[model samples]
Target: MHSAIAPIPIDLIPSWLDVLAVWATVGAALVAAVTGVLIWLQILQTKRSVDATEQTLTLAREEQEQNRELIANARKSRIDAELPKILVWIHTQTRKAHDLGVRSASGAPRPLTELPAGKIWSLPDDGASELFISLTVAVSNDGPRRARVTLATSNNSFLLSENEQVISVGEETLIEVRRKYTIEDWAAMSSEVGTRSIQDVLTLTYVHQGTEGAIERWVVRQSGSPLVPVPGRQNCWQLGPFAARRGPLTSLTAEVEMPHRDYYSSMSDLTVLV
Candidate 1:
Protein backbone atom coordinates (compact mmCIF):
# COMPACT_ATOMS: atom_id res chain seq x y z
CA MET A 1 0.00 0.00 0.00
CA HIS A 2 0.97 3.58 -0.61
CA SER A 3 1.16 4.22 3.04
CA ALA A 4 3.89 6.83 4.09
CA ILE A 5 7.05 4.95 5.30
CA ALA A 6 8.30 6.01 8.63
CA PRO A 7 11.31 8.40 8.39
CA ILE A 8 14.67 6.62 8.09
CA PRO A 9 16.41 6.31 11.38
CA ILE A 10 18.78 9.33 11.81
CA ASP A 11 21.30 7.40 14.06
CA LEU A 12 21.74 4.85 11.29
CA ILE A 13 22.44 7.65 8.78
CA PRO A 14 26.11 8.68 9.29
CA SER A 15 26.88 12.41 9.92
CA TRP A 16 29.12 14.44 7.41
CA LEU A 17 32.04 14.49 9.86
CA ASP A 18 31.81 10.68 10.21
CA VAL A 19 31.61 10.20 6.47
CA LEU A 20 34.74 12.45 6.02
CA ALA A 21 36.56 10.40 8.65
CA VAL A 22 35.74 7.16 6.75
CA TRP A 23 37.01 8.63 3.48
CA ALA A 24 40.21 9.81 5.19
CA THR A 25 40.86 6.33 6.66
CA VAL A 26 40.49 4.70 3.16
CA GLY A 27 42.89 7.24 1.61
CA ALA A 28 45.50 6.59 4.36
CA ALA A 29 45.38 2.79 3.77
CA LEU A 30 45.81 3.30 -0.01
CA VAL A 31 48.83 5.56 0.58
CA ALA A 32 50.43 3.00 2.89
CA ALA A 33 49.94 0.20 0.28
CA VAL A 34 51.48 2.35 -2.49
CA THR A 35 54.49 3.23 -0.25
CA GLY A 36 55.15 -0.49 0.43
CA VAL A 37 55.06 -1.30 -3.34
CA LEU A 38 57.54 1.52 -4.05
CA ILE A 39 59.93 0.21 -1.38
CA TRP A 40 59.81 -3.30 -2.98
CA LEU A 41 60.66 -1.82 -6.41
CA GLN A 42 63.63 0.08 -4.98
CA ILE A 43 65.00 -3.16 -3.41
CA LEU A 44 64.84 -4.93 -6.79
CA GLN A 45 66.69 -2.05 -8.53
CA THR A 46 69.42 -2.05 -5.89
CA LYS A 47 69.94 -5.81 -6.27
CA ARG A 48 70.21 -5.47 -10.07
CA SER A 49 72.77 -2.66 -9.73
CA VAL A 50 74.93 -4.75 -7.36
CA ASP A 51 74.82 -7.72 -9.74
CA ALA A 52 75.83 -5.46 -12.65
CA THR A 53 78.79 -4.06 -10.73
CA GLU A 54 79.98 -7.55 -9.83
CA GLN A 55 79.75 -8.61 -13.46
CA THR A 56 81.80 -5.61 -14.53
CA LEU A 57 84.51 -6.43 -12.00
CA THR A 58 84.64 -10.01 -13.19
CA LEU A 59 85.06 -8.89 -16.79
CA ALA A 60 87.83 -6.49 -15.84
CA ARG A 61 89.76 -9.21 -14.03
CA GLU A 62 89.49 -11.56 -16.99
CA GLU A 63 90.65 -8.86 -19.38
CA GLN A 64 93.55 -8.00 -17.12
CA GLU A 65 94.70 -11.60 -17.00
CA GLN A 66 94.50 -11.89 -20.76
CA ASN A 67 96.56 -8.72 -21.18
CA ARG A 68 99.24 -10.00 -18.82
CA GLU A 69 99.57 -13.23 -20.74
CA LEU A 70 99.85 -11.34 -24.00
CA ILE A 71 102.56 -9.06 -22.58
CA ALA A 72 104.59 -12.01 -21.29
CA ASN A 73 104.38 -13.76 -24.65
CA ALA A 74 105.47 -10.59 -26.43
CA ARG A 75 108.51 -10.21 -24.19
CA LYS A 76 109.56 -13.79 -24.75
CA SER A 77 109.22 -13.42 -28.48
CA ARG A 78 111.33 -10.28 -28.43
CA ILE A 79 114.12 -11.96 -26.56
CA ASP A 80 114.14 -14.89 -28.90
CA ALA A 81 114.37 -12.58 -31.88
CA GLU A 82 117.18 -10.42 -30.47
CA LEU A 83 119.50 -13.03 -28.92
CA PRO A 84 121.87 -15.00 -31.16
CA LYS A 85 121.50 -18.77 -31.44
CA ILE A 86 124.80 -20.23 -30.20
CA LEU A 87 125.77 -23.07 -27.88
CA VAL A 88 129.18 -24.15 -26.57
CA TRP A 89 130.77 -27.01 -24.57
CA ILE A 90 134.37 -28.02 -23.81
CA HIS A 91 136.40 -31.13 -22.90
CA THR A 92 139.95 -32.60 -23.20
CA GLN A 93 141.54 -32.62 -26.66
CA THR A 94 142.19 -36.21 -27.69
CA ARG A 95 142.40 -35.92 -31.48
CA LYS A 96 145.80 -35.56 -33.15
CA ALA A 97 146.90 -34.76 -36.70
CA HIS A 98 148.00 -38.13 -37.96
CA ASP A 99 149.80 -36.60 -40.96
CA LEU A 100 152.53 -35.05 -38.82
CA GLY A 101 153.80 -38.41 -37.64
CA VAL A 102 157.21 -39.53 -36.40
CA ARG A 103 156.89 -43.22 -35.63
CA SER A 104 159.38 -44.73 -33.17
CA ALA A 105 160.60 -48.35 -32.83
CA SER A 106 157.15 -49.20 -31.43
CA GLY A 107 155.44 -47.36 -34.35
CA ALA A 108 154.38 -44.65 -31.85
CA PRO A 109 155.63 -41.12 -31.35
CA ARG A 110 158.58 -40.94 -28.96
CA PRO A 111 158.38 -39.18 -25.62
CA LEU A 112 159.89 -35.73 -25.21
CA THR A 113 163.24 -35.88 -23.41
CA GLU A 114 163.19 -34.48 -19.89
CA LEU A 115 165.40 -31.37 -19.86
CA PRO A 116 168.66 -31.75 -17.99
CA ALA A 117 168.93 -30.09 -14.58
CA GLY A 118 169.92 -26.35 -14.70
CA LYS A 119 169.65 -26.50 -18.52
CA ILE A 120 166.97 -24.40 -20.24
CA TRP A 121 165.20 -25.42 -23.43
CA SER A 122 164.90 -21.76 -24.47
CA LEU A 123 168.66 -21.13 -24.81
CA PRO A 124 169.16 -24.50 -26.41
CA ASP A 125 172.68 -25.64 -27.24
CA ASP A 126 171.23 -26.93 -30.55
CA GLY A 127 168.09 -26.17 -32.61
CA ALA A 128 167.01 -29.77 -32.01
CA SER A 129 167.23 -29.15 -28.27
CA GLU A 130 164.45 -26.51 -28.42
CA LEU A 131 160.91 -27.73 -27.41
CA PHE A 132 157.30 -26.76 -27.97
CA ILE A 133 154.36 -26.62 -25.49
CA SER A 134 150.69 -25.94 -26.28
CA LEU A 135 147.25 -25.61 -24.70
CA THR A 136 145.36 -27.58 -27.43
CA VAL A 137 142.12 -25.63 -26.99
CA ALA A 138 139.09 -27.09 -28.77
CA VAL A 139 136.47 -25.09 -30.70
CA SER A 140 133.15 -25.86 -32.37
CA ASN A 141 130.45 -24.02 -34.29
CA ASP A 142 127.20 -24.59 -32.37
CA GLY A 143 125.10 -22.08 -34.28
CA PRO A 144 122.68 -22.01 -37.21
CA ARG A 145 125.01 -19.83 -39.27
CA ARG A 146 128.68 -20.04 -40.21
CA ALA A 147 131.07 -18.16 -37.91
CA ARG A 148 134.76 -17.20 -37.76
CA VAL A 149 136.65 -17.19 -34.48
CA THR A 150 139.54 -14.86 -33.69
CA LEU A 151 141.51 -14.96 -30.49
CA ALA A 152 140.28 -12.14 -28.24
CA THR A 153 141.46 -12.45 -24.67
CA SER A 154 144.34 -14.88 -24.22
CA ASN A 155 146.13 -13.84 -21.03
CA ASN A 156 149.40 -15.31 -22.41
CA SER A 157 149.15 -17.85 -19.61
CA PHE A 158 152.48 -19.53 -19.23
CA LEU A 159 150.60 -22.81 -19.28
CA LEU A 160 148.24 -21.77 -22.11
CA SER A 161 150.26 -20.42 -25.01
CA GLU A 162 148.63 -18.77 -28.05
CA ASN A 163 149.76 -19.81 -31.51
CA GLU A 164 146.76 -19.74 -33.86
CA GLN A 165 145.60 -16.19 -34.60
CA VAL A 166 142.26 -16.87 -36.33
CA ILE A 167 140.00 -19.83 -37.08
CA SER A 168 136.93 -20.40 -39.28
CA VAL A 169 133.81 -22.37 -38.31
CA GLY A 170 130.81 -23.66 -40.26
CA GLU A 171 127.45 -24.78 -39.01
CA GLU A 172 127.89 -27.77 -36.72
CA THR A 173 131.66 -27.63 -37.13
CA LEU A 174 134.18 -28.86 -34.55
CA ILE A 175 137.95 -28.44 -34.32
CA GLU A 176 140.91 -28.93 -31.95
CA VAL A 177 142.81 -25.67 -31.52
CA ARG A 178 146.63 -25.90 -31.62
CA ARG A 179 149.12 -23.31 -30.41
CA LYS A 180 152.94 -22.96 -30.15
CA TYR A 181 154.88 -22.14 -26.96
CA THR A 182 157.81 -19.89 -26.14
CA ILE A 183 160.09 -20.27 -23.10
CA GLU A 184 159.94 -16.54 -22.46
CA ASP A 185 156.39 -17.16 -21.16
CA TRP A 186 157.74 -19.59 -18.58
CA ALA A 187 158.59 -16.81 -16.17
CA ALA A 188 154.92 -16.08 -15.41
CA MET A 189 154.04 -19.70 -14.55
CA SER A 190 155.01 -21.84 -11.63
CA SER A 191 157.34 -24.82 -12.04
CA GLU A 192 154.53 -27.23 -11.20
CA VAL A 193 151.30 -26.84 -13.17
CA GLY A 194 148.60 -27.33 -10.54
CA THR A 195 145.68 -29.74 -10.81
CA ARG A 196 142.31 -28.21 -11.67
CA SER A 197 139.00 -29.06 -13.35
CA ILE A 198 139.89 -26.89 -16.36
CA GLN A 199 143.52 -25.96 -17.13
CA ASP A 200 142.39 -22.53 -18.40
CA VAL A 201 139.99 -20.73 -20.73
CA LEU A 202 140.27 -18.71 -23.96
CA THR A 203 137.90 -16.00 -25.18
CA LEU A 204 137.07 -15.69 -28.85
CA THR A 205 135.29 -13.09 -30.94
CA TYR A 206 132.74 -14.76 -33.18
CA VAL A 207 131.84 -12.96 -36.41
CA HIS A 208 128.59 -13.97 -38.07
CA GLN A 209 128.90 -14.50 -41.80
CA GLY A 210 130.63 -11.64 -43.69
CA THR A 211 130.31 -9.22 -40.81
CA GLU A 212 133.75 -7.92 -39.97
CA GLY A 213 133.11 -6.67 -36.43
CA ALA A 214 132.53 -9.25 -33.72
CA ILE A 215 128.87 -10.05 -33.06
CA GLU A 216 129.13 -12.35 -30.07
CA ARG A 217 131.57 -13.73 -27.51
CA TRP A 218 132.70 -17.36 -27.42
CA VAL A 219 134.49 -19.06 -24.54
CA VAL A 220 136.45 -22.33 -24.73
CA ARG A 221 137.90 -24.54 -21.97
CA GLN A 222 141.46 -25.83 -22.00
CA SER A 223 142.14 -29.54 -22.05
CA GLY A 224 143.20 -31.68 -19.09
CA SER A 225 146.37 -30.79 -17.22
CA PRO A 226 149.86 -32.42 -17.18
CA LEU A 227 150.36 -32.57 -20.91
CA VAL A 228 153.09 -35.15 -21.55
CA PRO A 229 155.29 -34.09 -24.47
CA VAL A 230 155.52 -36.57 -27.33
CA PRO A 231 159.05 -37.82 -27.84
CA GLY A 232 160.94 -37.69 -31.14
CA ARG A 233 158.27 -35.16 -32.05
CA GLN A 234 159.50 -31.55 -31.66
CA ASN A 235 157.30 -30.58 -28.69
CA CYS A 236 153.68 -31.67 -29.34
CA TRP A 237 151.85 -32.52 -26.13
CA GLN A 238 149.35 -35.36 -25.82
CA LEU A 239 145.98 -34.52 -24.21
CA GLY A 240 143.22 -36.82 -22.94
CA PRO A 241 142.30 -38.74 -19.84
CA PHE A 242 144.22 -41.85 -20.94
CA ALA A 243 147.32 -39.94 -22.14
CA ALA A 244 147.38 -37.85 -18.96
CA ARG A 245 147.05 -40.97 -16.78
CA ARG A 246 150.06 -42.60 -18.47
CA GLY A 247 152.14 -39.47 -18.00
CA PRO A 248 155.56 -38.44 -16.63
CA LEU A 249 158.25 -41.15 -16.67
CA THR A 250 160.03 -41.60 -13.36
CA SER A 251 163.38 -41.86 -15.17
CA LEU A 252 163.12 -38.47 -16.91
CA THR A 253 164.22 -35.07 -15.60
CA ALA A 254 162.06 -31.89 -15.57
CA GLU A 255 162.23 -29.48 -18.55
CA VAL A 256 162.05 -25.71 -18.73
CA GLU A 257 158.77 -25.82 -20.65
CA MET A 258 157.21 -28.39 -18.30
CA PRO A 259 158.83 -28.00 -14.87
CA HIS A 260 156.99 -30.88 -13.20
CA ARG A 261 158.66 -34.33 -13.19
CA ASP A 262 155.37 -36.03 -12.00
CA TYR A 263 157.51 -39.16 -11.30
CA TYR A 264 161.06 -39.67 -9.96
CA SER A 265 164.01 -41.19 -11.79
CA SER A 266 167.56 -42.44 -11.07
CA MET A 267 170.77 -40.46 -11.57
CA SER A 268 172.17 -42.74 -14.29
CA ASP A 269 169.18 -41.89 -16.64
CA LEU A 270 170.40 -38.29 -16.64
CA THR A 271 171.99 -37.92 -20.12
CA VAL A 272 172.78 -34.30 -20.89
CA LEU A 273 174.83 -32.34 -18.33
CA VAL A 274 173.07 -29.20 -16.95
Candidate 2:
Protein backbone atom coordinates (compact mmCIF):
# COMPACT_ATOMS: atom_id res chain seq x y z
CA MET A 1 0.00 0.00 0.00
CA HIS A 2 2.79 2.38 0.73
CA SER A 3 4.38 1.76 -2.69
CA ALA A 4 1.08 2.59 -4.63
CA ILE A 5 0.89 6.07 -2.99
CA ALA A 6 4.28 7.12 -4.38
CA PRO A 7 3.60 6.06 -8.06
CA ILE A 8 0.83 8.67 -8.64
CA PRO A 9 3.30 11.70 -8.88
CA ILE A 10 5.27 10.28 -11.89
CA ASP A 11 4.04 12.81 -14.52
CA LEU A 12 3.58 15.88 -12.23
CA ILE A 13 5.63 19.15 -12.55
CA PRO A 14 8.31 20.20 -10.04
CA SER A 15 7.13 22.13 -6.91
CA TRP A 16 8.36 25.59 -5.81
CA LEU A 17 10.28 24.09 -2.90
CA ASP A 18 12.23 21.78 -5.28
CA VAL A 19 13.17 24.71 -7.57
CA LEU A 20 14.15 26.89 -4.61
CA ALA A 21 16.48 24.11 -3.31
CA VAL A 22 18.27 23.85 -6.71
CA TRP A 23 18.81 27.67 -6.93
CA ALA A 24 20.10 27.75 -3.32
CA THR A 25 22.72 25.06 -4.15
CA VAL A 26 23.97 27.05 -7.19
CA GLY A 27 24.27 30.28 -5.11
CA ALA A 28 26.32 28.48 -2.44
CA ALA A 29 28.81 27.27 -5.10
CA LEU A 30 29.25 30.86 -6.46
CA VAL A 31 29.92 32.24 -2.95
CA ALA A 32 32.53 29.57 -2.31
CA ALA A 33 34.40 30.44 -5.54
CA VAL A 34 34.46 34.18 -4.68
CA THR A 35 35.72 33.40 -1.18
CA GLY A 36 38.56 31.26 -2.61
CA VAL A 37 39.67 34.11 -4.91
CA LEU A 38 39.60 36.60 -2.04
CA ILE A 39 41.72 34.27 0.13
CA TRP A 40 44.37 33.95 -2.65
CA LEU A 41 44.51 37.75 -3.10
CA GLN A 42 45.00 38.21 0.64
CA ILE A 43 47.93 35.70 0.64
CA LEU A 44 49.61 37.51 -2.28
CA GLN A 45 49.22 40.90 -0.62
CA THR A 46 50.77 39.51 2.63
CA LYS A 47 53.76 38.11 0.71
CA ARG A 48 54.41 41.48 -1.02
CA SER A 49 54.27 43.28 2.31
CA VAL A 50 56.88 40.92 3.77
CA ASP A 51 59.22 41.41 0.75
CA ALA A 52 58.92 45.22 0.99
CA THR A 53 59.79 45.14 4.68
CA GLU A 54 62.94 43.05 4.00
CA GLN A 55 64.13 45.46 1.32
CA THR A 56 63.71 48.45 3.60
CA LEU A 57 65.64 46.73 6.37
CA THR A 58 68.45 45.84 3.99
CA LEU A 59 68.71 49.43 2.76
CA ALA A 60 68.73 50.74 6.30
CA ARG A 61 71.60 48.43 7.23
CA GLU A 62 73.63 49.54 4.23
CA GLU A 63 73.07 53.19 5.12
CA GLN A 64 74.22 52.53 8.66
CA GLU A 65 77.48 50.99 7.45
CA GLN A 66 78.14 53.94 5.17
CA ASN A 67 77.62 56.36 8.00
CA ARG A 68 80.13 54.46 10.12
CA GLU A 69 82.74 54.59 7.38
CA LEU A 70 82.23 58.31 6.91
CA ILE A 71 82.68 58.94 10.61
CA ALA A 72 85.92 56.91 10.68
CA ASN A 73 87.36 58.80 7.72
CA ALA A 74 86.49 62.14 9.29
CA ARG A 75 88.27 61.20 12.49
CA LYS A 76 91.41 60.20 10.61
CA SER A 77 91.39 63.46 8.69
CA ARG A 78 91.23 65.48 11.87
CA ILE A 79 94.16 63.58 13.36
CA ASP A 80 96.24 64.07 10.23
CA ALA A 81 95.54 67.79 10.28
CA GLU A 82 96.81 68.09 13.82
CA LEU A 83 100.12 66.29 13.14
CA PRO A 84 103.34 68.29 12.95
CA LYS A 85 105.22 68.77 9.69
CA ILE A 86 108.95 69.47 9.88
CA LEU A 87 111.53 70.07 7.19
CA VAL A 88 115.32 69.93 7.56
CA TRP A 89 118.09 70.95 5.15
CA ILE A 90 121.72 71.81 5.20
CA HIS A 91 121.90 75.59 5.14
CA THR A 92 125.61 76.30 5.08
CA GLN A 93 128.95 74.63 5.66
CA THR A 94 132.30 76.23 6.57
CA ARG A 95 135.81 74.84 6.83
CA LYS A 96 138.52 76.20 9.13
CA ALA A 97 142.19 75.21 9.17
CA HIS A 98 143.80 74.20 12.48
CA ASP A 99 147.41 73.45 13.28
CA LEU A 100 148.35 70.80 15.81
CA GLY A 101 148.32 72.23 19.37
CA VAL A 102 147.53 75.65 17.88
CA ARG A 103 144.45 77.86 17.61
CA SER A 104 142.43 77.91 14.39
CA ALA A 105 143.06 80.63 11.84
CA SER A 106 141.85 84.04 12.99
CA GLY A 107 140.39 84.83 9.57
CA ALA A 108 136.65 84.50 8.97
CA PRO A 109 135.52 80.92 8.31
CA ARG A 110 135.93 79.95 4.68
CA PRO A 111 132.61 78.87 3.13
CA LEU A 112 132.73 75.62 1.19
CA THR A 113 131.16 76.37 -2.13
CA GLU A 114 128.89 73.66 -3.39
CA LEU A 115 129.37 72.48 -6.92
CA PRO A 116 126.39 71.67 -9.07
CA ALA A 117 123.63 69.81 -7.27
CA GLY A 118 125.07 66.43 -8.17
CA LYS A 119 128.62 67.29 -9.17
CA ILE A 120 131.76 67.04 -7.06
CA TRP A 121 134.01 70.01 -6.18
CA SER A 122 137.74 70.54 -6.77
CA LEU A 123 139.57 71.87 -3.70
CA PRO A 124 143.05 71.72 -2.12
CA ASP A 125 143.52 69.82 1.15
CA ASP A 126 146.64 69.92 3.38
CA GLY A 127 147.76 66.39 4.25
CA ALA A 128 148.36 65.47 7.92
CA SER A 129 146.68 68.66 9.17
CA GLU A 130 143.73 68.93 11.57
CA LEU A 131 140.46 70.23 10.13
CA PHE A 132 137.30 71.73 11.62
CA ILE A 133 133.98 71.55 9.78
CA SER A 134 131.03 73.63 10.93
CA LEU A 135 127.60 72.82 9.54
CA THR A 136 124.53 75.03 9.92
CA VAL A 137 121.29 73.16 9.48
CA ALA A 138 117.94 74.85 8.98
CA VAL A 139 114.87 73.34 10.58
CA SER A 140 111.47 74.64 9.61
CA ASN A 141 107.88 73.94 10.50
CA ASP A 142 105.55 73.85 7.52
CA GLY A 143 102.39 72.66 9.27
CA PRO A 144 99.82 74.47 11.39
CA ARG A 145 101.06 73.03 14.69
CA ARG A 146 104.00 73.81 16.96
CA ALA A 147 106.31 71.04 18.20
CA ARG A 148 109.29 70.39 20.45
CA VAL A 149 112.00 69.00 18.23
CA THR A 150 115.18 67.07 19.03
CA LEU A 151 117.83 66.10 16.53
CA ALA A 152 120.62 63.49 16.30
CA THR A 153 123.03 62.37 13.63
CA SER A 154 124.22 58.92 12.60
CA ASN A 155 127.85 59.96 12.92
CA ASN A 156 129.13 60.15 16.48
CA SER A 157 131.65 62.88 15.62
CA PHE A 158 129.16 65.58 14.67
CA LEU A 159 127.91 67.64 17.62
CA LEU A 160 124.28 68.71 17.40
CA SER A 161 122.01 70.98 19.42
CA GLU A 162 121.78 69.98 23.08
CA ASN A 163 118.19 70.69 24.18
CA GLU A 164 114.80 70.38 22.60
CA GLN A 165 113.95 73.34 20.37
CA VAL A 166 110.43 74.69 20.21
CA ILE A 167 109.59 75.49 16.61
CA SER A 168 106.51 77.49 15.72
CA VAL A 169 104.52 77.24 12.55
CA GLY A 170 106.25 78.81 9.52
CA GLU A 171 109.30 79.56 11.63
CA GLU A 172 112.82 78.40 10.87
CA THR A 173 115.69 77.77 13.31
CA LEU A 174 119.36 77.09 12.74
CA ILE A 175 121.23 74.25 14.43
CA GLU A 176 124.99 74.18 14.43
CA VAL A 177 127.06 71.00 14.17
CA ARG A 178 130.80 71.11 14.60
CA ARG A 179 133.24 68.26 14.00
CA LYS A 180 136.99 68.03 14.45
CA TYR A 181 138.89 65.41 12.51
CA THR A 182 142.56 64.46 12.69
CA ILE A 183 144.69 63.57 9.70
CA GLU A 184 144.27 59.89 10.51
CA ASP A 185 140.48 60.17 10.57
CA TRP A 186 140.47 62.12 7.36
CA ALA A 187 142.64 59.50 5.71
CA ALA A 188 140.28 56.79 6.81
CA MET A 189 137.29 58.63 5.36
CA SER A 190 139.09 59.36 2.14
CA SER A 191 140.13 55.76 1.53
CA GLU A 192 136.56 54.76 0.71
CA VAL A 193 135.88 57.66 -1.66
CA GLY A 194 136.04 55.68 -4.86
CA THR A 195 134.96 52.33 -3.51
CA ARG A 196 131.97 53.61 -1.51
CA SER A 197 130.49 56.91 -0.50
CA ILE A 198 130.46 57.85 3.18
CA GLN A 199 126.95 58.84 4.25
CA ASP A 200 125.46 60.38 7.42
CA VAL A 201 121.88 60.00 8.60
CA LEU A 202 120.03 62.64 10.63
CA THR A 203 117.06 61.74 12.78
CA LEU A 204 114.53 64.24 14.08
CA THR A 205 112.17 63.38 16.93
CA TYR A 206 109.23 65.64 17.66
CA VAL A 207 106.42 65.88 20.19
CA HIS A 208 103.19 67.01 18.54
CA GLN A 209 100.42 68.84 20.39
CA GLY A 210 97.16 67.71 18.89
CA THR A 211 93.49 68.60 19.36
CA GLU A 212 92.29 68.54 22.99
CA GLY A 213 95.90 68.93 24.08
CA ALA A 214 96.77 65.35 23.21
CA ILE A 215 100.44 64.52 22.96
CA GLU A 216 101.91 62.48 20.10
CA ARG A 217 105.39 61.47 19.07
CA TRP A 218 106.80 61.34 15.55
CA VAL A 219 110.12 60.85 13.74
CA VAL A 220 111.70 61.95 10.46
CA ARG A 221 114.85 60.54 8.89
CA GLN A 222 117.08 62.55 6.56
CA SER A 223 120.08 61.26 4.67
CA GLY A 224 122.46 62.58 2.04
CA SER A 225 124.27 60.74 -0.71
CA PRO A 226 127.74 59.34 -0.15
CA LEU A 227 130.58 61.80 0.24
CA VAL A 228 132.43 62.17 -3.01
CA PRO A 229 136.09 63.07 -2.99
CA VAL A 230 136.89 66.40 -4.60
CA PRO A 231 139.49 66.18 -7.34
CA GLY A 232 142.95 67.67 -6.52
CA ARG A 233 141.91 67.88 -2.84
CA GLN A 234 143.30 65.42 -0.32
CA ASN A 235 140.96 64.41 2.53
CA CYS A 236 138.27 66.73 1.13
CA TRP A 237 134.78 65.44 0.40
CA GLN A 238 131.36 66.81 -0.54
CA LEU A 239 127.84 65.49 -0.05
CA GLY A 240 125.22 65.01 -2.73
CA PRO A 241 121.51 65.78 -2.66
CA PHE A 242 119.65 65.02 0.57
CA ALA A 243 116.42 63.09 0.95
CA ALA A 244 114.06 62.69 3.91
CA ARG A 245 111.62 59.98 4.98
CA ARG A 246 109.04 59.71 7.75
CA GLY A 247 108.71 56.73 10.09
CA PRO A 248 106.93 55.60 13.24
CA LEU A 249 108.10 56.98 16.57
CA THR A 250 110.00 54.65 18.86
CA SER A 251 110.55 54.55 22.62
CA LEU A 252 113.67 56.03 24.22
CA THR A 253 114.90 52.62 25.36
CA ALA A 254 114.52 51.18 21.90
CA GLU A 255 116.31 54.09 20.32
CA VAL A 256 119.17 53.75 22.76
CA GLU A 257 119.45 50.07 22.02
CA MET A 258 119.67 50.56 18.29
CA PRO A 259 122.91 49.67 16.53
CA HIS A 260 123.57 53.22 15.35
CA ARG A 261 126.49 54.61 17.34
CA ASP A 262 125.19 58.15 17.03
CA TYR A 263 121.82 57.35 18.52
CA TYR A 264 123.24 55.45 21.47
CA SER A 265 125.79 58.15 22.25
CA SER A 266 123.38 61.01 21.66
CA MET A 267 121.79 60.54 25.09
CA SER A 268 125.12 60.89 26.85
CA ASP A 269 126.07 63.75 24.59
CA LEU A 270 122.86 65.54 25.39
CA THR A 271 123.69 65.38 29.08
CA VAL A 272 127.20 66.70 28.51
CA LEU A 273 125.88 69.58 26.42
CA VAL A 274 123.32 70.40 29.06
Best by TM-score: 2
Q: Which 10 consecutive residues of model 2 have the lowest summed lDDT?
A: 248-257
Candidate 2 stretches greater than 4 Å from native: 1-76, 97-129, 193-196, 209-274
Q: Which tens-of-lDDT digit does each residue in 1-274 have in candidate 2?
A: 5655556565587789889999999999999999999999999999999999999999999999889778756654565566667666655543322333323367544443333453333333444445544456667888787868766665533544475788999999887654555544544554543422233434556643322222233322222222446557654655422221122211100111122111111232232110
- Estimate candidate 2's alpha-carbon lDDT, on a 0 to 1 scale: 0.50
Per-residue lDDT for 251 in model 1? 18
| TM-score of each candidate structure, all chains considered together | 0.30, 0.40
TM-score of 1: 0.30
Candidate 1 Cα deviation (angstroms), residue 114: 15
What is candidate 2's TM-score against the reference?
Answer: 0.40
**C-alpha lDDT values of all predictions:** 0.41, 0.50
